[model samples]
Target: MFIVSLIFFVLFLPSVSVSYANTLFLHIEGKNDTLSIYAETGTQTKSYQVKRLQDIEALYPLLQRRQIDRNSFEQLLRELGIEVFEPIHTFIESSSEIGFVMAENLVKLPLDLLYVKEIPLFLQKPITYSFTKINSQNLQFSNTLSALIISDKTADPENGTYFLKKLLPSSAEYYDIKDINLTQLESIQTKDVILISAHGRIRFDNNDCIGLGDEQISPSHLARLSPKLVYLDSC
Candidate 1:
């Protein structure tokens, strides 16, 4: 019986490990033209996609030169009203042809949805993206009335917390929590800004992103918590 139990445990161990390894906790927020992607690895979380597409696309050629094949390059040019080259087959054969096409036909045109909205998804850290405005001014930081910075023990010990701290006002308080427990939230000073920078997923359901931390909090719950201001920096 002991020998049989050992064999069964050995067979299942790899399966258990694979199951945990494949898990990717992601958060998606926004409606219509706006959307955000938040990803969590264990206790650490990062947020992206709240900026203008043109700015984000500028970083793409530097990061993903290899991924831009000839076909992709031509598609980009046609969208820009540049005359299509006749020798399509020759371009596909050359490894560096896409770079030349991009330089000639599409270089001057502003970044469209293909470059700005899509390419940033492939770049390395710290993942950069923009946020939606509570008010009308999207370009400036005026809409950012309040912010919160949450630090978990397992998160990046350096720049993660530092960036949030720098972005938030000196008046905003910082919190160190192991997880998002609602009981802990009660202690947060009322009418103060609330920012939860933690490892969790925000799901888009029925137009609003549902906040699921240690406890599941709806967008409405967040609105009620601080009527004046609320921002979730969760991943």
Candidate 2:
């Protein structure tokens, strides 16, 4: 799901003046036939559909490997419903940070590395999202809360994926955050896999919680799901 904190700013580019007008926030929900998109760009709301989810999933590899071509990139954009329309043929689309609210299993996707016509999307779209490799901080997974950093080979998030099953012990499950509540979250046992890659927040006025659609998962509730791996990769 895409949620943007709205703020306005101005910029002067040499002799020309161009300022950020808006941001595109897209929230994709449901599964299979139920899949739908909820998006917002400025005051305008846009809706789009894919020919088949399989058609889009097929392109994930191209993105992960950073092997992009106009055709494949076009397909991804078409399926994603990102397009520029009238009144403006071309416009500056730049952003500092990019965040994505996606399924835990898809967290390994190198979204920041995506490019269009050799230009990175972060510099081309006024959308918010981001990621990178840390030097001192290791990309980790856990069993019994014991640290297990990715090997140098698998740590290449730029060109590869962090295969949890290959790194963790026993079977695992990527919990789907669809209107999930504390009761459902707490029901999870030690054998279950816990990957909370969602929209999280720290409120000075109130206690922090994991934003899950209309619901919120508290830290105390989250502790109930004692799984072998807890990848709390959130924003």
Candidate 3:
């Protein structure tokens, strides 16, 4: 299975956005346009090379317009790799906490949830989003998840946002929506991990936007935030 395997790299996809999670990725250096993905454990590696890059890139706008679904993401996740994701491109670290990354610039899209083998059930429906954190020094794995969590009052109560609190109860520093802002995030320096539980949806103009109480974070805004372990519980 993709999960149990050590290193599963989705080198490229044809018409979809490709990604997998929870592994240590140093850097990606491939030879041709047709990339061979591999999963690595110790010295061995595995590849999930499906082959779509442009088609996946086109979906971002659709996602922003609130026209995409998990099925679309699930299908896309298995098909393409990107080249530019301004946010979270700094470097990813190793941790037990699960996270997702963009392929190619998959770096630029909404890298929310990650699963092995197949997309998760909850993610099989409509829209829901998530992100990951990183380590620049090494790909060392850890089982701890201590992060700065901003839980929006309007975050989904029955799904992801609700469950994470129960899962990491004491591992995170919880802050109400009213207490957080763009400045704090721009100057963020303390915690290495950040998980935001908020309402993320597309506005009339079709640009991606997340409503975090007084601040509605756009992708451009998301791009400006300092790089770190990030998670977005967008429902």
Give candidate 2 regions above 4 Å deviation.
Answer: 1-21, 33-35, 60-99, 103-235
**What local lDDT does model 2 show for residue 213?**
65
lDDT at residue 165 of model 1 (Cα atoms): 55
TM-score of each: 0.34, 0.31, 0.43
lDDT of 3 by residue, 1-235 (tens): 0111011221112444333344333232233343233333233333444333344445545554535575766565544323222112222213223233334434433333332235431243222112222322232223355556677665645444445456566765666778988776667554545566777654335465667667787755544443244566565
lDDT of 2 by residue, 48-153 (tens): 5433444444444444343457575655554343321211212223322223433433333333334445554545554332121111112133453322221122
Query: What are the RMSD figures for all models against the true structure?
Result: 20.8, 15.6, 11.6
What TM-score does candidate 2 get on C-alpha atoms? Answer: 0.31
| Poorest stretch of ten by lDDT in candidate 1 | 1-10
**Against the correct fold, how does model 3 do in TM-score?**
0.43
C-alpha lDDT of all candidate models, in order:
0.35, 0.39, 0.43
Tens-place lDDT digits, model 1, residues 56-105? 23433423343446565545534321211221222222221121112222
Candidate 2 vs candidate 3, lDDT winner: 3
lDDT of 1: 0.35
Ranking by TM-score: 3, 1, 2
